[model samples]
Target: MNPFLKPFACHWTMLDNVRVKKAGDIRLKATRSAVIYCTPCGRKLISQAQIDNYLHETKSKLTIELFVFDCKANMKQHYCPDGKILDADISNGQENVPISVVNEVDKEPNK
Candidate 1:
């Protein structure tokens, strides 16, 4: 398993330890065998990652344009069936802003 890829198993998490294949497909092998529940349906669904690896290889560089244009929809679709949309904090081959701030107020002077 790649050190950079963290294996996560939760009601709101996706499968882990994904590796790239020579045929340009992403393979997801679950580390655990427990049944996971779906957030929307409340039904049990096996934690699996069934998306094709868009990139050619791990060593290949990922460009910003490719991320936004090519891979975004494929990834979203992969999770759509399982109803796992990548959260802001979840960094899964996409650009995510960890923190979101609507507005900031100025501090008052000390009394």
Candidate 2:
């Protein structure tokens, strides 16, 4: 599995946008966009014109990311020109997950 995609988990919400899940004192905010590479291809820079073209052609929201596997091998595939949007949810387990920076006040006192 891709290291970037490993932290993500499927989270369905009634809201029109993505959501973040948290456990205990930890909180994860759903960023509007996050840079990520395609599973089939590597990170490639895209132009504004290309992104606009894709959005117009697909008739999809600008918040969505594009995957271009149909392009030729020589062609570069850039998913997010504006920035990669996070569509998946972050896991909320208390196991061996790496801890992100958090305020000390947010943590509970030791038992």
Candidate 3:
């Protein structure tokens, strides 16, 4: 069995206050609230469609990796796009910050 599928207490990033609008629209339309990340692996599973696709592709029966907190272990079980798992440290380090702030920072160009 893949160890990544095992359940663990996960530090989750809750998605809230998400909105979308046309280029000049004054009102921001609210989007559904969701839990976006497991934090430790930096992987996001935002919607049912996405979750279904992942399960279909991986043929995985477990959904625990989508929500569990111990993503470090999960991270070790997967490969990167380059066909390898990242060897460097993996940490979001913003576990205490609001998701809105994190989203803004993610939008900025890396210095």
Best by lDDT: 3
| Pairs of residues at least 3 apart in sequence or in different chains that clash in candidate 1 | 26-53
| Local accuracy by lDDT, each model | 0.30, 0.30, 0.41
Candidate 1 lDDT over residue span 1-111, tens digit each: 222112222222333344434343556655432322232224323323311122233232432222211212223333222222224344444555453222223333222
Residue 65 C-alpha lDDT in model 1: 29
What does candidate 3's lDDT look like per residue over 1-111, in tens digits? Answer: 335334233343433434324332323235433324333344455555665675577666556445433312333355433222222223455556433222232344324
Question: In model 3, what are the clashing residue pairs, if there are any?
Answer: 10-69
State the lDDT of candidate 2 residue by residue for 1-111, as single tens digits. 322222122221111122223222223345422222221122222333544464467564432333322222222233433333232223445536743332334344333
**Is 2 or 3 the stronger prediction by lDDT?**
3
lDDT of model number 2: 0.30
| Candidate 1 positional error at 65, Å | 19
Off by over 4 Å in 1: 1-35, 49-111
Residue pairs in collision within model 2: 34-84
